[model samples]
Target: MNTTPTIDVPVQVLSGPTVLIEYAGLRILTDPTFDEPGEYPVMPGYAMTKTSGSPLGTDEVGRIDAVLLSHDEHDDNLDRSGRAFLPRVPVVFTTISGAGRLGGNAKGLAFWDEATLTAPDGTVVTVTGLPARHGPEGSEPVSGDVVGFLLTAPGHPSVYVSGDNASLDYVQQIADRCAPIDTAILFIGGVRHKPMLDAQLVTIDNTQATWIARALQARRVIPAHFEGWAHFQGTREDLTRTFEEAGLADRLTYA
Candidate 1:
């Protein structure tokens, strides 16, 4: 086990909305979507297409201590391969309703709820659930429940993982609650389903992402979920340009 506290935490962006976070001697995976490019049925008439494959396979991830699932209802976030990978993991933290549906080894967390886990080196790490809205106001009933995450440990930089959220108001709330976030793994795809929610982004766009970084005062911002999906409206290039124009390019972790 690596007991040394890292000043710069390592984050690996596997694919859309999937990121592997290494902090405080713990290996945490966020929204594991390992399946290859294909179409996934969301509802009777609605389906989401994955246009790319994950950079790493499940076997390559080694040992994942916990899975931070923002929401389970969306296939783009948790596909067939991702679902299969869950049981192998020791624990999964997700929305309250998602936990109930997932059952075994899955624990539901309401907004602001915190869960403590011991790291490989016996260091204590706390993960707190944060608010998230998948779509416009009053869209929760149809869009399903979603939640972000905040990770904290003594003598370590705090980490924030934004789920599929679009509301800047929610970001403000998170900032007010947990400001000065050291690192932020943001989900930014600018997803738009015309029939479902006209012109409304399911996740934060480039502009909103920039605001989120400023609001949280994040030292390092790792962008994900901004590519490899059919519904996504924004791209990495756009995000880079947006941040650069805003004079925040220095804070981005393009790697």
Candidate 2:
């Protein structure tokens, strides 16, 4: 039996890359993709297809204080419908380029940069932008700039949100800077696009996720971005087996 305890904060995986996190008096979201199952043309000969949409969309999940967008370029992270939902939010934190492209309440953050959000009851949450590599090293030009986020407060558990990072070196950088992450929301799919990256893994696989859990010594790890798209290959069972084999099953939670 899985003996992992409950996560201090409330986290609900809406499907794919989207997640809802309730911290203290704050409501935060990540990479909202609300589009139904369909094929979207990203480039002339390239397309991404969604297999299914989440049961709950933006309207159902009310009162979002902020959105931690990994990147706005990809349809999987911010689909056409999700783009429409941005204006309704109070603040959006994303990469510098993404913020420039998406103005109006969207704030740009570089690696190691920080943003602040105040809760209703005089609580403050600090959001830090961290580095993320979508594919192999030096693939930014093709993959575009992606970002991760770290949420921290005076007395709250530290939470790390790994966007679409594939490189453990970058993750190690994060662990070195801030260890003992209380909660981690990892976007692992092990997705591969042969034409795009020549069949190279574009996202963290199950083994990498387990390594992250151990490296950060995370109490709870709620996974996302592992399904809903045809390109996604990592499954929950695969991740469970990997974590169990690594002796870190207790840290894995499907919250």
How well is each residue in 74-128 modelled by candidate 1, as lDDT tens digits? 8889988899999999999999999999999899989999999899888899999
Question: How far out, in Å, is residue 227 in model 1?
Answer: 1.2
Compared with the true structure, all predictions reach lDDT values of 0.89, 0.89
TM-score per candidate, chains pooled: 0.95, 0.95
Candidate 2 lDDT, 1-255, residue by residue in tens: 111234388899997999999986898999998988999997789898999898787789899999999999899999988899999999999999999999999999999999999988888889999989899988889999999999987768888999999989999999888887889999999988888878887799898899999887788998999989988885778889999999998888897
Candidate 1, after superposition: displacement of residue 26 in Å? 0.6
Over 4 Å off, model 1: 1-6, 43-46
In model 1, how large is the Cα lDDT of residue 57?
Answer: 93
The TM-score obtained by model 2 is: 0.95
Give the clashing residue pairs of candidate 2, or none.
none
